[model samples]
Target: MDTCYGTPNRKIVLLTCNVDDMTGEEIGFAREIMMKSGAMEFYTIPVQMKKSRPGFEIRVVSKPGDADNMAALLLKHTSTFGVRMQELSAYALERRSQVIHTPFGDVRRVIGEGYGVLKEKLENDDVCAYAEKAGVDRKTAERQIYALLEAEKQER
Candidate 1:
């Protein structure tokens, strides 16, 4: 199976929580729980509640598929009873992953283009191995290798 990342239509869902004001350690702990539950981005927004009491508004951003699990995580960690989830869609990009030959050996790079798309990034270990095998500098090998991928952008 091919390994890939950054898929098109990858929805970014925001999971927000309303909780009582607390210390940094408490907030950070909640943040960690939210992140491990599959949130890609996590943050806390400060808010002033009734009687000038301070609190935090926790927001968790993740893929659309993670909406349910993430919402549950927020509710469980922050003791929030309800959460609001919204869908935001946009065109991503067209990406293609390919393995090409280089003077050094083998290097990997992702080719991405503009709706849902993804490609691969070159692995340093792979490049080094090839460079060693080919008896060439890694930098030179990288330049020669990346040129092929650049040609793809020109084709556009």
Candidate 2:
């Protein structure tokens, strides 16, 4: 486990493998299996392998405790015979969720505090749902939510 100084921290394991023989459908299946097996994040990068063959390098991020399970899943679901593992530490800012009433509806905003400053972002799903419910475009809904948040900020 890796530790951070004076901040909330998490230890994660990164697993990477190069695969040259799996179809797109098979890759999607492997991604689902990895997610179900405790992979926090899974993605692939296109690369050219030996003999000029197009392939992908699959990368999986998992909690330290789930490393073994993730590795096993990768081995079973993908065509990779070997995996590279690395331990990593991450530090996150303090954050909290606040529900605000907007013209569209109630929306949740994530407020993060770091470096003596506050940063905020409106939840994407909430904004999308509000757009659907109000029959407005997504950009319009996003602007409305931002305007609401700005008003609240001024009030504070």
Q: Could you say which candidate leads in lDDT?
A: 2
Q: Which stretches of candidate 1 lie over 4 Å from their true place?
A: 1-9, 90-156
* Candidate 2 lDDT tens digits, 19-123: 999999999999998888779899999999999999999999999999998999999999999999999987666889999887778899899876455688889
Kindly provide the TM-score of model 2 when superposed on the true structure, using C-alpha atoms: 0.80
Ten contiguous residues minimizing lDDT sum, candidate 2: 1-10
Candidate 1: C-alpha RMSD after superposition: 8.7
Give candidate 2 regions above 4 Å deviation. 1-8, 103-105, 115-117, 153-156
Residue 11 displacement (Å), model 2: 1.8
Clashes of 2: 0
Q: For each candidate in the order shown, give its overall lDDT on alpha carbons.
A: 0.72, 0.89
- Cα RMSD (Å) between model 2 and the true structure? 4.2
The sequence of per-residue lDDT tens digits that candidate 1 reaches over residues 1-156 is 543354445557776776665678877887888777778789978888667888878788889988998887777767567788877664456667667765556666677764333445677887778767867798866665677668866989
What does the lDDT come to for candidate 1?
Answer: 0.72
Q: What's the C-alpha lDDT at position 125 in model 1?
A: 81
